[model samples]
Target chain A: MVYSISIFVSETQSAMKFGGKIGIVGAGALGAFYGARLYRAGNDVHFLVRTGFELIREHGYEIRSCDGDFTIKPPVYSAPEDLGKCDLILVGLKAFANHFLPEVLGPLATPNTVVVTLQNGLGNEETIAEALVKCGVHRSVAEASKQIIGGTAFLCSNRVAPNVIIHSAHGFVRLAEFQGSPKERTFAVAQLFLDAGISCEVRESLAAIRWEKLVWNIPFNGLGVAAHQADTAVILADPELRTTAVEIMKEVIAAAKVNGVDLDERLVADLIGKTEIMGHYKSSMQIDFEAGRPLEVEAILGEPVRRAQQKGFSAPRMHMLYALVRRMDQLRQSNLENSQSRSS
Target chain B: MVYSISIFVSETQSAMKFGGKIGIVGAGALGAFYGARLYRAGNDVHFLVRTGFELIREHGYEIRSCDGDFTIKPPVYSAPEDLGKCDLILVGLKAFANHFLPEVLGPLATPNTVVVTLQNGLGNEETIAEALVKCGVHRSVAEASKQIIGGTAFLCSNRVAPNVIIHSAHGFVRLAEFQGSPKERTFAVAQLFLDAGISCEVRESLAAIRWEKLVWNIPFNGLGVAAHQADTAVILADPELRTTAVEIMKEVIAAAKVNGVDLDERLVADLIGKTEIMGHYKSSMQIDFEAGRPLEVEAILGEPVRRAQQKGFSAPRMHMLYALVRRMDQLRQSNLENSQSRSS
Candidate 1:
């Protein structure tokens, strides 16, 4: 099994010299933004869209970027069966929609397919691995895990309308293999993004990068919504909230340390200082909340908190935020259901 | 000075046997309900009205209570000067409106006036005392504190309209002297509520009762607003939120203990159990948030958290709640001001 996995990883790495067939599983703001770039870079990229399938199929995808504008008329699929097998599958779905992974990836993933999840928070890679196993794409969790790569996309983009993505700033991505250190396939995937003009890097520790990203996400994203739809600037403007954001960051750093991922204490200050110049960036969670969409509470907060707690570390602020945001999401879901039922 | 206060306390106690001139400052829902009862009981009660001055004066005040309905055409004063001096002043103002305290109570309070603040959260008595000093009704903070009594009204009431109060249930009040142990003046004020056929009790330790009430308010009221306008039942219904509520209660209890008020740890369970039966009780803060009115964030949350922190104890959940709610209040206020200016 190890020999076959190593062989497949090397083959994937060598194949990265050419623009291999790639599948964009989510095709939302993040998916479409990155996927469009890849298609423009001459990859045979296919998008599996749900809501904007017809709009995207008819009008294609338009990227109104701060870096540069681009358009892609790639093939779009509404279902996994039509997406076809690909050498690389990039999952950019919101963590909340992750439950649909098994069905979505059932036909799209193959034994040699390298799956990269650039979703927020923890557990997306694990979910993808499980989905691969469940969908019979891989024989076991171990086999699936080797083919899975976890990524943190530090991108600021928004899908204002169907088939139209506005890329505001920062499209850097960090990639790492789920099972071990950055493998040959991980570098290959990073190369794909790098070739597409994205600032890409490969990390030895997936947990380290995920925790580092969470050091920013858990506080800013959580507080952005939890603080009554406050943006980054609004949070930084209030001294108490700024202190709270720092406290939350410290808690995340501590949680990361307990989980064997040593994050620098200065990362808190660094992230805050960087965010200070971001000029009122409404976090993705906050945006979802304002749009009355489901938040990635479990993935961004719940999973991290649970992971830390399993190792006997108490993150009171994170726990409080997770509970509050989870409740808010649950309330939003129920409210949406009620309104839908009333209208129907 | 001590002898004079002792003499005044006794005189105040004796004067409680008669109606005596009573001033009801901040005649909102709580003030209107209790003031109407005092008026109905034949006390010389005068209400200091603001927004509802004309409505209350023309139609009188109506109390639709679960206990019983009552109406009173007591004299209503739009300004404090018109309210005149009083033997006892019952303050029911929202803690946010406390800045107007010195101005509002300036003419209504005399050196002989016994002030009882039936407001939520900590620092109300201290605020009252400060207002008395600021208004020149008292020579010093010590004198003001001696005359000020703190009370927590466990009332389920709402002012549905101007001069119309709907009392759902629970009108019991717990009173204590702000300066020392419950003196004659404390019992005298308790008697005033008891005379109006309300459940009222006087306690020895002012801090003890105040902290005890906070054991409920800090969690239910804070979460009631912070958890996206969730009520008591909604908090108890979700297990995570229910757990968060308990954690907040524990923090409050610990805070109280460090501050020299050892609340029984079982108060956590007791309060949660009681809240389970409250049947969707919207806390005063939640109600205020829903109405887009100014929240008593500083009084209910900010002060208690600061008090605990001063004692070198950390209440992470309370601090987070305080920051979130305070930010929400600030955001709401700014939005309101913008709309008002735009309209103007």
Candidate 2:
């Protein structure tokens, strides 16, 4: 597993620096944005898109923002098999898509291929790390046991268009050793991202950053969704809710600190402020609410609070807000069910 | 003010038994229940009602519960002046109406009338007591209020039909003297209620009961409104939330203890359980939520928390919950205004 990961890492570094074939799996906002940027910088970028977004080639993606608009025609494919192996594969999607990712990424797994994940939240590394352990397999086992390279992508924001992702904001995208030591190839991959005008940080401590981001995401997103508000500002505008948000953030920080991140108040506050300035960024929470989707309540709100308690952190505010949001979500679900039953 | 209250007490005692007219202000649920029980037991009853409840006069007030329905008719007056002087007045309405209660109960007051309040939540006694002091009115206030009076009309559930109050669930009513001594007249009043089939308890320490009730109330009612859930059970159903509720109650109870009323944990739990059993009963907070009215957030959630904090009782749960519900109320108001503006 380690040998394969290193081989993949070397290829990523080579491809990123030398500007070779780069595949972006899950070409949604983050994927599309980074892919567009790399393509704009004169690198060959390919997108593995789902059926719904396959028409991106027909209608160009447009990113509406205060910043200047830029669009690009990165090659798009439905599956990795359609494009064969690439030097580096970037995975950008929601955490829930882990089950399908390995299969979707199968064709990109040459001996010298590396998968970089830019997905948010915790556990992506473990998923990818485990998949790499099962990399080589017989055809019968390959159907279920073939492993995929794990990658992490971190983007500021992307456009929601067909052909182009209007890159509005830029942030450092860190791809670390998902489960092994960073090789010379990893450093090259980081430099390649820089050469492509994408700020890339090769992290020795990727898990810490991922967990830190997750900590803030859970509270703010859950709060935004529960209140049916836009973002942190909508919640923070009220002093009490603001306090609650801070409290929740503190709990998250504590969880990370317990998990060995040692994030202080200042860093958490800065991250929170950054999130707010992403300006009208609706959290996945608000997105779910608007879509009437069953919220990621348990994972986003319950799990952290539960962990915090287990770690002996008195996360009073998180507990209260989590309960409040969970109950609200439950009510929303039951209300919908009632409405459906009545309509039926 | 003290002199007047004493004079009213003397007059009520002089009038004796079922002779003097009893005025029931805000003859909605509590008034209807209490008034009907008294009227049924042969006391002359008069009700002060607002517009739109004329139907109450014809069908009488009905209290429907598993226990059976009981109804009684007494004269109903829309305006305060329409009713003559009464020996006793029962103020049974929402706490928000306490501010304007003086206007409603003014005409019904004689020099020797005792005003018994059966309203829910904190500060009702203080409001009535302050009003009596300010107006230099002769009206005795009770520190403890009774849910039992409404219960005893055996009309656990009541619908006012015409001039009568129909009660369904007959239960015991608890009453106690204010901080001062329990006068002979207070006991006499208790006897009158008992004679009317309402089981009554005379509490030597009304403050403790009130504080105990307040501790239990802050968590359930505040959480119910903030969480937008129905009952105390919803708060308790989630173990984390229940622990939070208990923590909040402990703080409030500690504050109350500081204020001279020590409430044990068992009592708080019992009160919470009772509120749970009163299923589908929207708290004053929920009622305010539905009615688009300003909540008694201060009295119900804030004051206790504030007092607790002042008393060095760390009620983080209560404080946080208070802030959330207050914000929710404000946002709801803003939403109302925005919608109204759009409509206009």
Candidate 3:
């Protein structure tokens, strides 16, 4: 498994003692939030931004957070060549954007830099592992996988404006070694977030962490779009839907168990009960699809369904949702293309 | 089971030869199409229309069929007290609108009336059955069920105008005796359609027929809405969606087996192959949802999923789709209400 890492690169070498030189790639909501936190924590943090670079540079990042409000102006770049080498790289991009990583990481990533993934779904680690060997940055995938850290962000924040992010609820993470045990660097990374008033814990197994997070994502994200942008409260309120959500969560837990991760059934009840209080919160996938952006269908839905099927345990709900989302995404793309052609 | 009877009252009861006085209740697409066919065959057919009663009474019915085009100017009535009793009633309303059966069937339906439901999904027969008993027109539900005919329309048609209906493809039906074996009335009804260019056959049991039709309806209807108004051709064209559809069909068959209906797996393949040539045809449920009308969630999806669960078989796919469609329907309704309030 590859980690969806979102590391921060500090400019001052003296501040590197906390977590070393970090490269923050895919600086979307998650990357920007965490990177901003690290930057404000006396570390030399830099951001590799694609969009809103000018706005962020001019106004800085304003975090209207649930905990407290803060702002930080970090170094920003578009090209990876400008960043040089780093001690660690953190990727907070969406799984759908993982395809463009070769261009983003080819020149910037080195043989020694540790990569951590903070994206949703399965196969990100493997994707990064393969991309590493493909780019000749690393000689072998196994060696590259060893340098990766698995991350699960339990944060709820959105970039409300070009230079502003709003952290609504949670701002915590569960970090782990990617296909390996927790290392000294993992503890060091957790300490950095802990020092910044954010909760971070280093778990032993990456697969367990990934599948556990999927317990919420698979049902919520998939159902949100399928239900025509229904929110968490709406889903919890409807009896049939509420039952269906639980069923899908159970299927995810079953798949995790098959993959050697034992999850308690109580976890489902607890998650559902807690989410009931979430009000009308639209999921990330629902938000993306509604905004006419590409969804992370493969990593979030397809891979999990495929993995379960490979183990001879058919997750009917996940497979059905996967197919629906895939087809919807195709239609959206085709419709967009037609409109673009007409405009052209 | 209550039948959704769509019967037409002939003006001249003395001229009841081909099929006797018929009352066409819920004269939407299926009811209007078949009622027109019967009326053309010299039956005393009268329609009880609600929404388009004035338009249909003035212009009659124009059936633009793939087989051929035809027109009929039938007697129309709004109130059941106006139509009197009929020998046979053919129902063509959606399952969601089955609640209005008491108003439609009270005075027009007699104890001797043969109620044939041409609606989709399960429990329509029961709803109609209970409505008959509640009307005090019948003593028992079982007795009322005996007077009901279970019919599955294989035809594809749409009401393009208030009075014009376009029959695009198939014009056939599988007629069955509800809660009873094939009766003489069933054969007579079959012959009536067979005489006219439309194909009709008498099947043994209503439950078997309903479940068989569901083999196609469940997968297509559920996935179509879930996939954001995807049509038949789009579903068949996508390999993933096609596979998921087949799986759902198989689950329907399994649920049917628990209820003593034996359906072959070859049915799924046959339906898929036949539907592959359907082009971009929207399902009735999809059309209802797009038009802001209620879906047949209880009869089509919820009841089926619940039945399967009761039989100790978990249909995860159907359950998930049920939850999704249910949630989507609720959202649409709420959105409609919000829009109406804003406009007001």
Highest DockQ among the candidates is held by which one? Answer: 3
Evaluate model 3: give its TM-score.
Answer: 0.93
**Shift of residue B184 alpha carbon in model 2, Å:** 4.0
Q: Tens-digit lDDT track for model 3 on B55-122?
A: 88888899998878988999999888898899888888888888888877888889988898988998
Tens digits of per-residue lDDT for model 1, B1-344:
11011122233463546458999988898988888998888789998888878888989988899998878899998888988888889999999899999998899888888888999888888888888999998888888888888888888999999888999988988887888787666767777777788888777777888888899999888898889878888888888888888889889999998999877787777777778888888998999999998999999999999999999987899999999999888989999999999999
Q: Candidate 1, which segments miss by more than 4 Å at Cα?
A: A1-19, A54-59, B1-19
Q: Going through the candidates in order, state the TM-score of chain A alone for each one.
A: 0.94, 0.76, 0.93
Ranking by TM-score: 3, 1, 2
Q: What is the TM-score (0 to 1) of candidate 1?
A: 0.92
In order, candidate lDDTs are 0.86, 0.64, 0.83
Worst 10 residues of 1 chain A by lDDT: A1-10
Compute each candidate's TM-score over C-alphas. 0.92, 0.78, 0.93
lDDT string, candidate 2, A217-256, tens digits: 7767777865556376777676766776676677677777
Report lDDT (Cα) of residue A165, candidate 2: 52
Q: What shift in Å separates residue A245 of candidate 1 from its native position after superposition?
A: 1.1
- Report how far off residue B247 is in candidate 3 (Å): 0.9
What is the lDDT, from 0 to 100, of the residue A275 in candidate 2? 65
